[model samples]
Target: MAGITRRKRRSTTRPAAAPVTPVADLIRRDFTAPAPGLRMVGDITCLPTFEGWLYLATVIDLHTREIVGHAMAEHMRTDLVCDAIDLAAARGFINDDAVFHSDRGVQYTSGQFRAALAEQKIRASVGRVGSCYDNAVAEAFFATLKTEIGATIWRTRSQARQDVFTYLHYYNHTRLHSTIGHNTPAETRTNHYHQASAA
Candidate 1:
């Protein structure tokens, strides 16, 4: 018999990556804040297009349910999430020591994202693994968005981007939210600030 060897099959699965540092479940299923810029949640979603998928990262204010920051791109890389956070921060929507909660996505758990949060003086909060309830608010937001957008697919990414831009504006300034007593997110924020100043 001639000596022969068979090749070993390589494993296709990869291990789950842990967070760079210990982060707590700060939100703890209580997706509420006494005021704006105190607690926030963020998540990423994809839009279908003939050109390809358009990825969107959004930072939502917990109190008002407003998408204070967002970024869209063709890739769901760490930079995409960071850019979202940067936008939120640059707009002065995030306050120092504000808790930003997200699911345990790779981009959210990456060191680069942690550094970005640190740079903005925002504390990082992560939901429990495999628990959709842990991040329900952000999850629900996407569900509402896709349902309201009423588009199965777009002709191009550019078209998708434009529509998303239009949608975000409507969501923030026009759409009524039952969570905030049927007030728009912008209205909720403004009302809170106006009441605070008057008091």
Candidate 2:
């Protein structure tokens, strides 16, 4: 006790840091439609399987929030996007004046993809590089698909493919979107056509 000195230790606890918010300037602005059928958005998202990854490409009608067409493949190539576009055209959702918007991904900017759009007489619009908001709706859909239906890992590609097909059907038929007044895309499109006819 004669020469004992006790020093108190500092507390190890530290205050939690504030959550990071993306800078407003860094956030990309959403594209506005010039006219119906004049603007569309497209994107690709990957689904994981125990065996491998499955890629999904989609073309959505901005006016109706309807997925005009989509395609899934074992690989993400120019053909994936082109095949979706072809399906959309076959469904009569695309026109010569349609403006196709997508992020500046290589698959979209590749010569083969450009050629496909050009052959259809559709104009290509590229979003700013590395900006997710520029294609926010498409991103949102992918997020929803992953959260609501897609599994993190499937036992096989066949299972993943079946699940993807089922999810797409529900997405196009049953998913209610707040942006479209809580209506499914198909219902919204039908209502829009009805209103247009009445007008």
Q: Which candidate is the best by TM-score?
A: 1
Model 1 pairs in collision: none
Clashes of each: 0, 0
| Model 2 spans > 4 angstroms off | 1-28, 31-36
* Residue-level lDDT tens digits of model 1 in 48-69: 7768778889999999999999
Over all chains combined, what TM-score does candidate 1 have?
0.91
Runs in model 1 deviating more than 4 A are 1-16
What is the lDDT of every predicted structure here?
Answer: 0.87, 0.72
Best by lDDT: 1
